[model samples]
Structure formats: structure tokens, C-alpha cells
Target: MPIQHINPPGLLQFDAMSQVVVASGGRTVYIAGQSASDVNFEVVGGNDYYAQSVQALRNLRTAVEAAGGSVENIVSSTVYLKNLTPEIAGRFLEALAIACEGKSFPPHAFSLIGVASLAGADLLVEITAVAVIDAAVAA
Candidate 1:
């Protein structure tokens, strides 16, 4: 990946992202926001937020990986949940941490929001992420 880690003499690079992610020599891929849908596009986990969250992440991972990037390469993520509360957010974080075990430089920019409803009645959560895969790697 041409995504180089930047450092300023007195700055904390670990907590901050590169000022500008130069993707010149790499292929940029954009994945539409993904919902918790199965192979048949049938939304999963009707009323179960946690289950739906799990499924959403799984779906997001699959899409990103298919595009030549892994979840670990994800630089940003946005999660939309229905009726999200502090407790529910914590649960989602926990699940995310578990799923990212052993993956370095896990998602840096993360956003979570609660929405009134999703596209389908059975959908409870949706996740979208951006990853940079070096063009050389993809080639």
C-alpha cells in the first residue's frame, strides 16, 4: 500500500491518520454502504441489533476483500444502527474489536449513528468502509 504512516517530530502518529492519503500509484475502490443482507439479499436479524451488526460487518468485510482489500486495510468506517444506545454502541465496539483481532492498523476513522429505519424491515444495521490497496498488489 502507498499509504505511508506519517510522523511529525513531536506528534503522535499512532493516534492520527496521515494528513493526506496519497493514492497515486494505487487503485481506489469504493464500496456502497452495506447492510446485513444474506446471499439472496434477504436482510438478516430482523429485531436483533447485535446480530444484525455482526452480519453487517461480515458483509462489509466480504465486499472489501473481494475488491482486493482486507478489513485490516480499512482506513475508515461508518456504522448506522437503528435505535442505537450507549450500551448497544459498546456491544458493537466489542464485536468489532473481536473481529479485528490480529489485524494491524485497524480502522482509524469510525463513525456510528442511530437511524429511525433502514431500507428493509429485517435490516437493523449497515456498515461502510474505505480501504486502500496498492495497485501493485492488486495487479
Candidate 2:
């Protein structure tokens, strides 16, 4: 399964994300929405969106790896923010960049939402992702 990332000219040069991700060659994994909760389901990084986003990304990584995929395989994701702000958005992206092993990763596409709340008051972020698992890699 060969996944091709397409970045057409005149458009934004995609970073961690691509404008179009062609993963038609393998299995697509739809990971459930994840928040900044620990193994005990207790929310972490209370009141800090950056910390919460980092935790959420970690959860996403765990799920992806468990499915025989890596975070790089994620093609798209949607982020939910309890209190959206410019600083918060920047912090989230900063945390994400760090999570991507200090490299640029935007994925194929992403949608960020401003929400009143999440599953709990302590939670500040939740992320749902879609990824492709190469058959050979999964094997």
C-alpha cells in the first residue's frame, strides 16, 4: 500500500498535512474522538489548552500504534477546543509540532472547533482522526 501526498502548485505547500492524501491503497482507520485524559480517564492539563492538546495527541498516537500505524499515517483530524483563542491555537500547533518529532505535520486536513465544553469540565481539547494503515506495515 503506497500512500501518495499531493501538493499542487499555487496552493499552500502542505506541511504536516497535505491538501490531498491518496491512501486508497490500504485500510483506513477511523479513530474515535480523544480528549486529554489519562489511563484512568481523568482529565489532564486542566485549564491549559496546550498541555491538553499534547495529551490528546499522545492518546491519538497510542490508538494509531495499537492499530499498526504511526502518527505520520494520519491523513486527517478534527480538533475540539473548549475555549478557542489565538494563543491557544498557536500553542496547540506548537504542541503538535513537537509531537510530530519536531517536524512539520499538518496532516491532509484538519478542522478546529470552538466548543462550550467537552466530556468533562476539566477537559479542554478532544481530537478525532482518520489514518491509513499500509497493509505491509500492518503485517
Candidate 3:
């Protein structure tokens, strides 16, 4: 599949959503809200935002790849947190940075949201994304 990126002049030249158009066409994989849970479906991080965010991202990655996708296939991701604070946001970014280490992941549309809770009480973060895989390419 062919992908195109567009960045207008009006908005700030930021990474996420600093542009308008993302991809042209492909097979879309819609990942559900992935929480900080392991194969057993138990929350990995208790109340820690950083730990939870990291685990959530990891979960998201696994789901995407299992569905015949990859990190580079992700076109957009939404991060849902228990609270949206500067410190928390920083921690989340840190977690993301660590998780993306030694990977071919690229920046995509990102949005952060503050929610009262998630699937479980102890969970603190949930990540969901849209991945586009070319039909000719296998996974």
C-alpha cells in the first residue's frame, strides 16, 4: 500500500497530528483498548502510572502484531489515563520512549484522555491504536 503524510502551515509543526492526511489505503486493524494486563488478564502495574502505561503499550504492540501488523503499521493511538497531569504525562512519555527502544516505530497521531477508571480498579492506563497493513505484504 502507498502512504502519504500531509502537514499544513496553520497548525504547529509538532509530531503527532502536526499533519493532516496520514495513509492512503490499506487493511485496517482496529485494536481494542489494551490495558496493563498480561496473558492471564491480570493487571501488571498496580497504581503506578509509568509502569501501567508501559505495560499497556506492550499489550497494544502484541495485539497489533498478532493481527498481522507492526508498530510501523500504527497510524494513530489514543492513550487513556486515570488522570491527566503534567507529571503523569511525562511519565507516560518516558514509558513510551523506553518501550520503543531498538524498534522501528514511527510517530503517529496521539491523543491523551483522562478517565475515571478502566477495566479494573487497579489499572491506570489503556492504549488503543489503528494499524494499516498492506494487502500484498504478509503481516
Please report the candidate that would top lDDT against the real structure.
2
Best by TM-score: 2
TM values, all candidates: 0.73, 0.85, 0.83
lDDT per prediction? 0.66, 0.80, 0.75
Which pairs clash (backbone N, Cα, C closer than 3 Å) in model 1?
none
Cα error of candidate 2 at position 66, Å: 0.8
Better of 1 and 3 by TM-score: 3
Enumerate clash totals for all models, in the order shown: 0, 6, 0
lDDT of 3 by residue, 1-139 (tens): 5444556677666543425436646888899999998888898887888888778878888898898877767777888988688899878877876665534235666788988888878888988888887733222
Better of 1 and 2 by TM-score: 2
lDDT of 2 by residue, 1-139 (tens): 7666777898787455577666767789999999889989998887888888888998998999999998877878899988788887888887777765566554566777888888887888999999888833221
Scored by Cα lDDT, where does model 2 land?
Answer: 0.80
TM-score order of candidates, top first: 2, 3, 1
Candidate 2 residue spans exceeding 4 A from truth: 100-106, 135-139
lDDT of 1 by residue, 92-117 (tens): 76556545342323534667899888
